[model samples]
Target chain A: MIKIETCLTPEILHLHQLEGKIAVVTDVLRATSCMVAGLNAGVKSVIPVKKVEEALTYAAKGYVTAGERGGVKVEEFTIGNSPYEHMEEAYHGKSICMTTTNGTVAIDAARKSADQVVIGALLNVSSIGRYIKEQQKDVIIICAGWKGNPSLEDTLFAGALVDQLKEEVEITDDATYMALSQYQSAKNNLSEVIQNHASHAKRLSGLKAQNDLAFCATEDYCDVLPILNGDEITIK
Target chain B: MIKIETCLTPEILHLHQLEGKIAVVTDVLRATSCMVAGLNAGVKSVIPVKKVEEALTYAAKGYVTAGERGGVKVEEFTIGNSPYEHMEEAYHGKSICMTTTNGTVAIDAARKSADQVVIGALLNVSSIGRYIKEQQKDVIIICAGWKGNPSLEDTLFAGALVDQLKEEVEITDDATYMALSQYQSAKNNLSEVIQNHASHAKRLSGLKAQNDLAFCATEDYCDVLPILNGDEITIK
Candidate 1:
């Protein structure tokens, strides 16, 4: 049986054995969701940088810079960390150099540790699940929680992915079981549950990004599976 | 309104701002439950040491040495981590120097970061709730997860404590909400849920410690509030 586990936050990612595992790194409050939506909407590739300065360096090389620090667009970047921003038709066929507080850090970390790293979000959960089953490898869902702590939206995405692959995978760890259970509890009213309970959702709402919250909660909306190829994330 | 948060594992304890907060550290499958049960059964101050060698050092001073590593009793220690062993009248009035894989490490970490650190478990969850309510301080439920990973039983205990104080405190963080929701799901048949889902329970059961699991699941059986005072845990 293939073992399925979850690292609830990037802070605890070190505790998980990532070698020989397919790492599904998710940041549902935007990062991974935006990547999935962007790739599906025709963005060529996404280069996730850990810092705004790195993204700015990519911008000089003709890559569109997208960044957000605390749910707000970085003043130096052309766009922010939002699915809608990335989904714009004007950005079609272009490469994106993105940086965020949590998501990019998680992606960078997972890339170094796991044999295979894929971006996951509610928007592309089913696609990620299908990819994992085909690979038939041990799975680790890494939640890019808010600034080194656990976040509800990312965890819910982890749970949703677990729910998608529960029958095909062995859920032996507590974090995976907890994530599956939490997803079961919120699956019926995911959007409402997230908007009401997630601290990141409230932060986004305060920044007038409620639509982004609602959009990111939509499951299986994008078929594009963003997988890390060297340093850049591209459609698998 | 006081905010309540959860540090799901000791690995992420540094992310939590524990200053002036009441830190309730729990390891329900054993450790903290054993401490609560031992104290309630009339054992004098329980000293939680991080290493088995430290526990053995205390043994020379007439303190009962109890230790467990990976759910088995240490060869050098007198007893393993079990609430049943701790409840024995033979140990009454004797101080215990205890060490375990996960629980003691968590307790030691919490005591240093938080203004006050208290042992928490299903056995004495109600007492912890009452104490927190009276203190009226912001609370951080530190789950002594199985070796730097989150554990189902400890998270459930955190949830039970959250349920107890939900009306009095503001539940702000996702981990706290997740714990409270998880506890609500299992509260109806907590023992069964734990026995089936908790990894630590299975680990203990392998060592013929199933009775310890059932005993630790018994809520409100002990009113003893184990608080850290200068490296020693005593009744408050």
Candidate 2:
């Protein structure tokens, strides 16, 4: 049976038994969207590093560093976390060493034991859902929440993906049901739902990151399925 | 400021910084309902024990032991998990020892460090909301899910409670907002929303615990505020 469950935040990822499951990690506000956009725009690969220093190490080794902390660009990084930056022609055919406040940490955690770890966001949720359905593996969605707490965008993304695959799979737990219900309720007015209701959206508004929010909220905007290879992600 | 947030399950309890907050824990499927029902029925107090052995010890001390695991009554306990059982005159004016798979563990976890921990259920949500507003404390709703996962019934109850208090309280996080939105959307047909959607409801149906689910799903059926005093719950 195709059983689907969701880890609402990476904080609770350790509690989930992901031994034989496919883990789709989402940090939809920016990080995962950036990675998806990068890979779709023909970047060689996206290397997710947990620490800013590690991103810097990759920069020294000729990869471009794209880092953000607390919604601001890292001091020494070549690019900030804007998805538009990755969509630029100069970024094409280059490797990116990326680090974000939440997504990289979740990726590192999921890397330890999940049979397969794939990056997901609104940009590529449809593609990722189809991929999971094709694999026929039990699914676990790990939401890369803001600093270990749930953010609405990631959970809604999980719900949206569940909506895509629910006809072909069984929801394994109540959280998955809640996510699917949430998506069902909010899918029609998603932009309004996230912009006015999500804490991260409100937070990003204060930081004048409206462009990033607009881009991240767009559904099926990219078709790349960025799967983890060792510590880096490449489009499969 | 009266701030409201939710820990969707005890598995995510540590992520919530609950040092000075009023922790309102809910296991809406039955445990909190039983505690609230017992207190409202004039029981002296309800002691929530974490282990079956602990409950058995309380039984040896002339206390009535009420325990459940996997949606059924403990083999050694007198009563199953029905709130109706706790409302009996036999339980009146006496201390009842209680343990359940999920609720007791969450209570024990919150009891260790929270400034104040209270039990909540649909039976007394209005009373609990008014009580929290009166206390003027920042509130955290802990959902005692099956094992360490999020359950729909508890989250919906949390959402219902947030719907009650959002006018006076500032939601401190996105999860709170999400819960409130969920409640707003589901409150119109709460019975349908919970009975049709919650995994626990389906599980209980399989176990023939339909009566418990029906009882637990009712709203504002009692007016007890089951506050934890030391380790036991006493109505306030």
Candidate 3:
């Protein structure tokens, strides 16, 4: 059976053995969700950078610089970390160089450790499951938590992904079991559960990004599978 | 409102703010459970050491040397990490120098970071809740997971403690929220849930420690509040 595990936060990613495994990195509140939406909207590719300065450097090469520091968009970026911003016609056929507090760092970390890294979010949950099932490889779901802390929304996404693929794979550890259990409990009303229980969702709501939260919580809105090839995430 | 949080595993303990906060450290399958049972059975004080050599040094000072590593009792120690072993009449009024795989490491970590550190388990869940409520300080429930990875039993205990104190304190962060939800889902049948879901419980069962797992799953078996005062844990 294919083995599956979960790293609840990027802070604990080091504890997970990602070598030779497919790493599905998730930032459901916005970052990975934005990638899924952008890719589905016909964006050429997304280059996830760890710093806003690195994203700005891509702007010199005509790439769209998009990022967020806290919940707000960085003043230097052309777009923020919101999924809706990436879903517009202006981003179609364009390459985005994106940076955010948690998502990019997690992606960068997973790329170095795993044999393959793919972006996962509620927006492409079923697609991710289908892609992983076809790969038939050991998988680790890495949650891009808020600032080295575990985020409820990311975990919820991880759980949702586990719920999708548990029957076809062997859940390896307690982290995966916890995520699956949490997802099982909250699957019926993910949007309401996340809005009420997730700290990052509350932070986003405070910044008037309630629409982003609702959009990110949506399941299978996009079938695009964002996989890291060299440094850029493109459709697999 | 008093703030309450959970450090799901000791690997992520540094991410939590423990200073001036009460740290309730738990290793439900069974280190902290052993401490609770020992203390309740009239053991004078339990000195938790991180290394086998450190525990052996106290044996020279007439303390009962007790511990386990990888679910087996250390050959150098007089007793293993079973609650039943700690509850024996031979241990009454005697001091124990104990070391275990995860629990002592977590206890040592929390003792240095938090203003006060106390041992917790399902065996003393209600008592731990009452004690923390009386303290009225910001609290962080530290789960002594298996090695550096999170364990289901420890998370379940953390959730149970959160369930007991949720009405009296502000549940802070996503970890606490996750713990509370897990506990809520499993509260009706903790023993069955743990027997089926916890990796540690399964490991213990493999080691012929099924009785220990059942004993540790029991709630309110003891009201003893084992608080770490300097180097030793004694009744608070």
Candidate 4:
């Protein structure tokens, strides 16, 4: 009985028994998308740190630091959370320290229980889906929602992944069905569907993130699977 | 701002600062629907107890005790958790002691912080919508999901209510948007939509609850808004 469950937000991660399961952490608005883009763009590795100061420590060294606090560039950091920024050739063969409000927090939490934690986003949906199918393990897709609330982008992304894997595993919970249904409904018109109503989309657009939003919504744009090893994310 | 939010499951109730807000508890499958039906049938009051022993205490006092623990009638209880069973004139002007797996537990939790807590369900969607609009206060819709995980039925009901009330309030979080989108997509064929994926619906149907499922899914079937004053559920 292969069980597939979803943590709609990081706040409920504690309630799930994730030990020995493959945890796919998705912060689709940009965290996982950015990290997956970094690996796909040929970055050496991405170190996920929970604190801004921790990212600063690696920046003080010759390693580049890239992160956002409230969807904007952190002070003194060389890069912000745009996938477009990470796709540049200059990032190739260089490791970067990264942090974000929701993504890294979820990655750190999933790290404690999951035997394997990987970054997931629309950018690498197929890659992550393929990887999970190959592993043949029970999977838990954790959506790194805004703070403690769910984000439509993440849930939609989870539904996309579920759509890919549903025939292979039993979706044991209704939350997963909810996501799959939402995704099925929104899959046809990703941008217009999500942008019209998503709270995070509204917040990001208010901060002028139209370019990033469009970039993140394009499904399977990258073939990178940013697998988590200890505290660092590297392409598998 | 008259903010509107939703707890997709009872486990996330602590994440929302529900203080000074009107909490609307929804367990669409049976509990809230049954309570709303009891109120509509002219029951004097329905006390929500969190435990079987607590309900038994009320039963000792000659009060009608009705509830379900694992989707079946409790032993020695006169009636089960079906709305149809409670629509009898025998229950009129009677205060029944009610307990269920998820609904009352949620109502008990909401009572601790919410300025006012009321039961909301498909049976009383219009009535609850009217009540919330009249209160003109911030609202939190609590979906009493199956156990601690999110349930499709409760979330769909929340989405239906969000669709009703979104224009009048500021939806402060993404969970609310998720629900609203779901409702928008599923509203046309709610019974078909929800029955397709809801885990609780499948479980109940397996236990010969087809009638109860159909009864609970009907929109505006009952007109009573069962308001929770402390622990007891009574109409306003």
The 0-to-1 C-alpha lDDT of every candidate, in the order given, reads 0.88, 0.88, 0.90, 0.88
TM-score of each: 0.97, 0.95, 0.98, 0.94
Q: Per TM-score, what order, best first?
A: 3, 1, 2, 4
* Candidate 2 pairs with clashing backbones: none
User: Where does model 1 sit among the CAPRI classes?
Assistant: high
TM-score, chain B, predicted structure 3: 0.97
What is the per-residue lDDT of model 3 for residues A120-201, given as tens digits with 9 covering 90 to 100?
9999999999999999999999999988878888888889998989889888788889999999999999999998889887
Which sections of candidate 2 miss by over 4 Å?
A: A206-208, B206-208
Question: Candidate 4 chain B: minimum summed lDDT over ten consecutive residues — where?
Answer: B202-211
Find the candidate with the highest TM-score and give its number: 3
Model 4: how far residue A115 lies from native, Å: 3.0
Encode model 3's per-residue lDDT on B72-163: one tens digit a residue.
99998989989989999998999999999999999999988799998999999999899887889999999999878888889889899988
Model 1 lDDT per residue over B1-236, tens place = 87899988989888778999999999887899889999999989889999988888898887789969988889888778878888889999898899999999998898887999999999999999999888989999999898889999998998999999888889878999999999998899999988898877776654458777788889999687999999799999
Q: What is the C-alpha lDDT profile of model 4 across B141-181, one tens digit per residue?
A: 99999888888889888888988887898987878878888
Which wins on lDDT, candidate 1 or candidate 4?
Answer: 1
- Over A39-137, each residue of candidate 2 has an lDDT whose tens digit, in order, gives 898888999989999998898998899979998899999999888898789989988999999999999989899999999998898999889878999
Residue-wise C-alpha lDDT for candidate 4, range A102-182, written one tens digit per residue: 999999999998989988999889998899888899999999998887889999999999999988989988889889989
Candidate 4's TM-score: 0.94
Candidate 4: stretches off by over 4 Å? A205-208, B205-208
Q: How well is each residue in B1-236 modelled by candidate 2, as lDDT tens digits? A: 79888888888777788899999999988899988888898889989989999999888888898979988899999897888898899889999999999999999999988999999999899999899888999899998988887888898899999988878998878878878778888888887878888888887765347767777888899888888998778988
lDDT (Cα) of model 1: 0.88
